[model samples]
Target: MTAEFWNGTMAAAAAAKQARVQVNAAYPITPQTHTVEYLSRFVNDGELDARLCKVESEHSALSACAGAAAVGARAFTASCSQGLALMSEVMYFTSGMRFPVVMAVANRTLSVPVNIWADHQDTLVNRDAGWIQIYTQTVQEIYDLILLAFRIAEHEDVCLPALVAYDGFILSHASEPVHPLDQAAVDAFLPPPGSADRPLLDPARPLQFGEVLFPDWYPDFELKKHRALADSLGTIRKAFEEFEAASGRRYAPVDAFATDGAEMVIVGLGSMMKTARHTAEKLREDGVRVGTAALRVFRPFPAEDLLEAVGGCRTVLVLDRDIGYGTGGMVYPDVTRILYHEDHRPDVLNFIVGTGGKDITPATIERCVELARGGYRGRVEFWPDARGAEEGVPYTEEPAAP
Candidate 1:
């Protein structure tokens, strides 16, 4: 197939169309609006034979999808940031019901003062919502992972919801060359609609869904869901291998670059890792043994794969785009916890960067490397120093020196 120019939204919409999604329910939200808009066009033009539910709110949109999935439909939806937060209540409901609903999250910062840009805060905050979270670095990955999310989510052993997230404007609005799979190829890769054998809320079968579970059964069911997510790691790996066999592209939970004999390795998730990898390569050229490892699968945590990637390095600099308020970087603690019990653990430093649309340039990553090399004492530090301003000055303005 020939490569076509597409932004992240188009790629995601194309993948959902190719997957033969039977139902798409979404309320328009920035960064995410373009994807649903494209899907709406596909449905209106008869290019895709799917029900387009224009819901009243993001919560209603996911509820519509969950209802569709409950009846054994191949359902999909897209939302990010505040929209995703609105969908939070239903997110747990959908996952608890074991619906194979797939959602595309255009990673955005949650608003307090209302800002729209790229960050992992929105999705990372929902990491424990029982949905398989997959982060992407490129438009092609957004396309591939959305397709794979359906396959993985619908798998009988992994009948849980999945989220494929990519940077909001960084990839969502930016165009890139993408070789999209044909419908035939996708149909071959993904099971035909209604092929998955699972308990569905059917009039004929009369299965109950979302029933109020008392405390006695609630904990057990929750345990089952937890085990299912943990066990789905193997199923996800199998799906990745199968997808690679079908398409010439390969994917893994953790993607490592130039880490063979590196002393310092940068670790991160989403689109910023592209910059981190480039920075690592440049540093290597300048006689600095730096490498990068990106976590593609965030929910399952991919601890072993990540351990293998950065285990040999002397220092692991974690570049997190989201802050955990009182705690620290969202991903930093996970990396530290994973390496804490290791026999030869690397020194891990967390640097929060690119919040609320701040650009994560190569220089930003270089600065992180410089700090890590200098044996910085702080466990967590914000790039560009959040406290750079004098007490009386606004953060946006330059501080007057004493």
Candidate 2:
């Protein structure tokens, strides 16, 4: 793969700029703002042949995108946190109508106290929507994954909207060497939405897209969406294979590193997986058997790969940046899905870190291994406090800064 350097936000933003979209509409929010901003300039300066729409709000941004793509135009948008929540209704309608409108979400913690930081709560809340969701673990992955997202979402069989995300400040602002990707090569990979392919929006053959569905047909559509979601697992693998062939860099629903012979492992999504990988290597060097996996694609929850990856490990620790309110954390319950279904299960430890862009240092990872080894299975393991334990926090990547 060609190598280069870019911050996560820039990589993602540049991907949007590079991809051949026909129309762009979005309301800016921190972290996700750079994407639409770059596209707006791209359109203004004649770099891209597309309409750059200025919208009043997140809802209008998505509404415009849906309207454009419905008219046979390739469309996209980006936002996060409160902005995503604000467009939550339109988000559902966009997907239900089966428009291939792909969005980039800067995953962030929802505000009550008005904090601007990274978390998965905003995207996770829309998990029920009929959208194909994909998560990333690095800036490089973020750059590449968006390319895949468009091709997958626009496929005739899929026709589902896609949401690609990276943690807000963690990955969005975090710098990493990444390829900008060859635009000519990308065009070759994904040709413009050809006529025979899909979305017969020809005025000569006018069609009604989303008619009202009652109980009988609603269930069928819902079943179709469910099957399509399941179908995406295979589609993603096929897409990755194609991407690997084209880019020469392989990816998977679950990307594993050095798991063999390890007695324990850690699982996490977004950029925190990078910290977990470094922590694993350090633990291995210290004679503590360990390995790590970036739980890259959360939606079709890579059940097979995850089960196989951690099956041999006696202990597995999962880190969730978003808490499921009274349920401690989300990943634990999802992990329990496999742990319960499997004949063999690892002793899974749940750890929450980097909730609000708290630096997830290696020391905290080591401590987590120690705590799990010590047989501590507290539902919520708060991060260490120098003077006293903090109530709201589930765990810190390090001792709280004094």
Candidate 3:
């Protein structure tokens, strides 16, 4: 393994090269364009012998990847926000067809307000599209997960596409220390392209794919997809274990911090969790029993691990970078669904913060803790709320005077 400083985009490209990706089909999109660009450079330099296919649109980018994977080749792509929105149609088909194509999603906010910065709105909007979604908190995790995503997606028990999403601009541009495994170790870990275990699109096999199914059989296919995702949880754990054995760093479905005997807990996803962890530690020093839990894997839902992380707390503050409008924050509803079913559920509250790349300071987390302690549980609370209309300048990540 080699350790060096790498930005999230560079790390992803490095990981893809190490995985020996046979093809990379991608379109240029903000925050994600550099990943494929780096891969293209690698291919051109003869450092990595991969076919870099440049497509016109994000949809075609993923479609080309799906086509490559169907032909039993390892493929990758990268996009964010509008790019992902455009690719939504193919995203479902990619998973439904059981292609093991992996994509790096530098998550950004959606439109209507016309934003182009970091947020979970992009990925969460397509949460049910059937891809294995793993959110990363750092450049190292992003690199490591990209390597591991291939193994998870291509596993016989899974055979599903996976997405490694990180906050756009934040992790994407930020450089950090990363330990990347050598190609020798990676080759031993992953099977070569067009391996017999993967489905082939060769004329010799003459197999059909995505044939029109009648209504009677459509639901069965959907159910099988669900079952395959559920069953893949076991495979996910096995892959994490193997990765941990090879690398000294350990990973879990939920990354928990100082939860033991805590009175309250904060739950979130992606880059904000690093800030949350610091907030939790500061709160601990202030004699507040607070802990933080960041969800790593979103597709399988990691229900059991999440429950264990926040079950004992008096209140659980769920933070989200995006709101689901009338319903509230996305993670809040799901967390409540599981918590409400338990015999004794903690008071789980949802608060939306750091949307469109706003800095989620320690003070903001402190405010959340205070509100949770004060029994404030009603609607989705917006952070950095200033005197203004909903469609005003303050809503953006513009600096506001204290």
Candidate 3: the clashing residue pairs are none
TM-score for every candidate vs. truth? 0.95, 0.92, 0.94
Candidate lDDT values, in order: 0.89, 0.79, 0.87
Best by TM-score: 1
lDDT (tens digit, per residue) of candidate 1 on 1-402: 799999999999999999999999999888889999999999999999999998999999999998898788999999999999999989999888899999999999998969889888999988999999999999999999999999999999999999999999999999999998877789899999767898877787786666788998888988999999988899999999999988989999999998888899899999999999988888988999998899999888899999889989999989889989887789998999989899997878778788988888898888888777876443545454344455532123332221
The number of the candidate with the highest lDDT is 1
lDDT of 1 at 324: 93
Runs with alpha carbons beyond 4 Å of true place in candidate 1? 385-387, 390-402
Q: Cα miss at 106, model 1 (Å)?
A: 0.6
Q: What is the lDDT of residue 61 in candidate 3?
A: 93
lDDT of 3 by residue, 170-217 (tens): 999999999888787888777776673866788988888888999998
Residue 240 lDDT, candidate 1, scale 0-100: 95
Better of 1 and 2 by lDDT: 1
